[model samples]
Target: MVQKETFGEVIRKLREESGLPLRKVAAHLDIDPSTLGKIERNERTANKEMIEKFAEIFSTNSKTLLVSYLSDKVAYEIMDEDCTKDILKVAEEKIKYYKKVKKLIVMPTKTKIKPYKEIDSDVLTLAEEEAYQLRIGENPDDIDLDVIDKINVWDKSVKVEENGYYWKGEPYITKGKLPANDKPLVVELFCGCGGTSLGFELAGFEIAIGCDIHQPSINTFKTNHPNVSTVLGDVRKVNPKSFLQLLDGRQVDVLIGGVPCQGFSLNNRKRHENE
Candidate 1:
């Protein structure tokens, strides 16, 4: 059987096929030839920008190239772990679900009306009171009235399912009305299980999107907030523009992230302050 080629191997093969020397390509990318060589040998990792530069040089799809590079990095990082295969399986499932949800949200349909008596009156009343307060001083056009409309939709009790996930309980609506002129929008990076997103939502912020590499964590997040868009992939592999695309022209009020901190955690087996 032929061995699988790594991202490094693919890059090296392309460079050799194009008859470009390491020094020449490195000069064009403004990186040292030694650094480029290490990257090709898998001794060093390339950032997203560097990978994009490589894609340009090789005339390849930047997203595909970045995914390959990130896959290699993830593999290397978890090589010594016993649950690597399980983790990857979960990641794949989560990514698949994320794509499905993204498609559904991008093209939503009108939800059918149901009897108001069957709905949760407490939540509906709260939503109505909040909406009234917000509209008291602001023009209707200035506010995202769609948010209130969403609350009204939730006034009907119905089971909803999307992309294999099901919900029949109270709708996961924001606790209060967002500001008429400035609804705070957040983009969360490394958003594990969406704890921060939940907090922000409770504080009346719109969670524009969230991203995480781990599959199980993202699955939990999706289960809780099915309406929020999420990306299941390595943050290093994702382009900044991709996050903007999720916003769909909405301005981001906050950008939050909780990067890997296992090495610094007190419970870590190999804890190090300098890490």
Candidate 2:
């Protein structure tokens, strides 16, 4: 059997077979040599633009290279666990069912639109399985019930206390100090509802503060993480001096942000509107 090569391995093999130096290829791709090396070694993930450049430089089919790149991403993410195969199998079935439903809705057929309560049990099972997979992926050992509970809370009105944070009615409270963390402080900008901040906190980083323009999002974030200060207002209009004041002379080890994706996202209401 021919051994299947990973995306990075294929890239490296193609480059070497073409007698192109790493530095030369990196320069052509307009990326740092170290970054290219990391990509070839599978230590780094390649973005769509980088993959496109690689495909162009190597004179390979872009779609084929893209598939390889995406496959590598899924492989690395799941780490090829036995459970992942089952999850993917169910996911594929769900996709097929969804497509069939969509076709029925769009094809002017006599098929009745199924209400939520009337949906197939198999669909519900698929959804539940997918959710379980996501939860397991995040908390492998099925630990951290607090985080899990908070994640399942769809209503903002419901109050739950866990891990040092308490949500009562509106504002939350920190029952104790931030777990005596010595890790570097992180400041998250455009932090909608604190999902990313929660991940960082779980990874042992102390989140000093977060900022966002949406009031409801800020409220949810504050309610979840009362220990971390939250600022509400347009990020562009917020003064840099204010951030320094929030830092209180402490060094900001890392700053993270997810810039608004509405303009670029296909699901956005104004996606087709010109900037």
Candidate 3:
């Protein structure tokens, strides 16, 4: 089973279930049979190329294997540490911040996104005191923390199974009685957990509906935007007339969303520069 299985265990299960022996996949990975066996037995790690090769040989989604491997790596790093969850929370924020900056900004300016842990205190102090006077007017507070709306495009967002708390964004804690402003009717496609939509709502927009192909995401979205309509399936097959009917004669303000970018998503696929 994929659930709760270590990376090694998952790979082993996949191979065994498919009735493929150890040497078959190992040959595909171009590694020795013993090494691949070690990988299956959790005695060794698999490289990115090996992970990619596994997907090819097994005819499986590369993302599934990649996700398992990355998560396993994280687990190993934090296995014996106290407050591992706390470390993960901070790491999540950092991942979002770094990814956001890399994808949308910094590329054109030749700006390098360095981790705060690497920066000297003196440099940070100077940045706090004098960065604003040089060009853009902003203090430590402005730069240290970010706008909620901007940060909402995180790699990970709120995930709740049932009657759970809203871990982030508006409708926080519970989807209590929401007073709406007469703003534009917002509908998001592939909206996961309603993070960005919630930002829009907080900025006074009325969220009308959210649709995604993921069941868990729809579950989360329904929890947050309790009043909003949600569709869960291939939106391509959905009848436009029926989709509009959900709007109930109200005009939509804007439609926005992008499909998953393989390398920079929750799966967070990593590869060698040469690969």
Which candidate leads the pack in TM-score? Answer: 2
Per-prediction TM-score, please? 0.35, 0.40, 0.39
Candidate 2: tens digits of C-alpha lDDT, residues 87-145: 77887899987675554332222443322222344654565545434433332244565
Best by lDDT: 2
**Candidate 1: what lDDT?**
0.69
Clash totals, every prediction: 0, 0, 0
C-alpha lDDT score of every prediction, in listed order: 0.69, 0.70, 0.68
Residue 215 error for model 3, in Å?
65
Model 1 over residues 182-233: C-alpha lDDT tens digits?
A: 6699888878899999899899888878777666777887887777777777
Ranking by TM-score: 2, 3, 1
User: Candidate 2: which pairs clash?
Assistant: none
Instruction: Give the range where candidate 1 is weakest over 10 consecutive residues by summed lDDT.
Output: 169-178
Clashing pairs in 3: none
The better candidate by TM-score, 1 or 3, is 3
The list of candidate 2 runs beyond 4 A from truth reads 47-56, 59-67, 70-215, 223-226, 231-275
lDDT score of residue 53 within candidate 3:
79
RMSD list, candidates in order: 24.3, 14.0, 22.3
